[model samples]
Target: MNTENARSQPPHEPSGCLTGVARGIALVVVLPVRLVWDALAFCLRQLWRWVLAPVGRALGWLIDVLLVTPLRWLWEWVLVPVGRALWWLVDTVLLTPLGWLWRWVLLPVAKGVWWVVDLLLVTPLTWLWRYVLAPVGRAVGAALAWAWHIAGVISRAVGRAVGWVLWNVIGRPLAWTYRVVLTPVGHWLRTWVWAPVAAAARAVRAAAREVRVALFGGSR
Candidate 1:
């Protein structure tokens, strides 16, 4: 068992030598690239911190001095007073007069026009609808209902009369003819004529059967 274990153990020296060679090669290949990356990062940080930041700050200050400050002053001093004066002028000149006219003249005129329209048109129309049209409509409706009732009565009476006439004139005669004439005729034919004919046929058939038996002899 000890010899078998020794035989199964794997060799390690060649693999260890190969691994060391690979690590050395990787270090040699990566050293220059790492140095170049570090240098580029340092340059970018310095450029942003010193050159680009100072330029941005100078530009912001110049813009504030040249454009923003003057515009702010103009808005605070010139535009505000001009706006206030214009608003005052408009209020005194236009709005006050228009308000006064609306309150004094136009309001009264509008009220008068509305009053005239209501008196002339609305009142008359209301009276006509209430007193005349409504009553007339009710009367017309009642008359139409009465006429319809009368028509229904007349129609019913006519139908009853027609039904009575048909029964007396046509139905009774047909019933009597069937009961008196056709029934007796049918019974007599069945009793006398049909019975005699049937009896004769039976006698002939029997005679034929006897002659056949006499000639041909009886069945086996």
Candidate 2:
């Protein structure tokens, strides 16, 4: 009855010797794995706090001391002076002469030429067209209208001849060539050639912008 009662109740705990053997196995296997994990964690923490952090700070300080400060001084002192001198040389040599030519030479000559045209050519032509030519043309037209049927035919023929002359001299072919040839050619050049060149120019400008940012520390 007691055995049956024991079986019905529950299983008993392991003996002390078996428990001792199990603990020994755990010490051999799990103890070393835990020790290795703790050692790795400790090494990583020391490396980050002591070695890597200090090295990063030292590299930053070294870069500031060696490279950045000297470049700034060189840009401020040497490059700025050289640039200013070159600009001054160009202004003195190239621009001053052009300005003098405009102010003293070319300007007076152009003014004189324009005055001559206005006085001799334009004024005379304007007076002739308004007073002489326009009056003669109107008188001739009025006389022809009163003459006969033959005069009407002659006037029509004259009108057609004048129109022919004007069309041949200045109208359709020049307009056609501009529309067909020049416009399309200009469009093609703008699309294929100028577009690519403009894109490359923009890329170069962007690279220059990056250089400026680096040189000026990205502030101004």
Candidate 3:
């Protein structure tokens, strides 16, 4: 009976030790698994943050491209058509009559102004020149002619008086000098220079006659 009791006690003590070791192993495994799960959740959260950040940027870009671009394009389209319509209206309605008037009426009137200028201004100027300036020029010319004639008369009278005095006072002496001095000089020049020149001319004539005869074989 004592052996049976000791065996039972030993078995019970080993069972309790096994239970405690099982509980400790379960705690260790569960703690590591929870840590792994928490790390996985954190990684998933970071990945989702990275992906959503790019998606938000893409959405913002799409909004700007879709809304702002179309709005700007529509604005340009509306403004361009309005500007063209305004320009067309101005050209066709307003400027057309102005251009026509400038071409036909205003141009003709401007050209006719030259004719009016010729009639009103040029004709009067020509008449004034002929009527007023011609008489004045002729009167001035006649006065100048009269003045010249008076001066000529005075000059002629003075010249005649001077001539008479010079004739009386100096002409006799000059004539005596011409007779005394020039008569001998003229006779000497005629005797020396003219006689030599005449003899040389006769010699040249004789020489020319001999040369002609020699060249033409005595001419005969």
Best TM-score goes to which candidate?
1
Model 3: lowest-lDDT 10 consecutive positions: 7-16
Please give each candidate's TM-score.
0.51, 0.45, 0.34
What overall lDDT goes with each candidate model? 0.92, 0.92, 0.90
Between candidates 2 and 3, name the one with more favorable lDDT. Answer: 2
Mind giving the per-residue lDDT tens digits that candidate 2 earns over 39-98? 999999999999999999999889988999889999999999999999999999999999
For model 2 the TM-score comes to 0.45
Model 1 residue 182 CA deviation in Å: 4.2
Question: What TM value does model 1 have?
Answer: 0.51
* Clashing residue pairs in candidate 1 (N, C-alpha, C atoms within 3 angstroms): none
User: Which 10 successive residues of model 2 have the least lDDT summed?
Assistant: 5-14
Candidate with better TM-score, 2 vs 3: 2
Please give the lDDT score for candidate 1.
Answer: 0.92
| Residues 135-162, model 1: lDDT tens digits | 9999999999999999999999999999
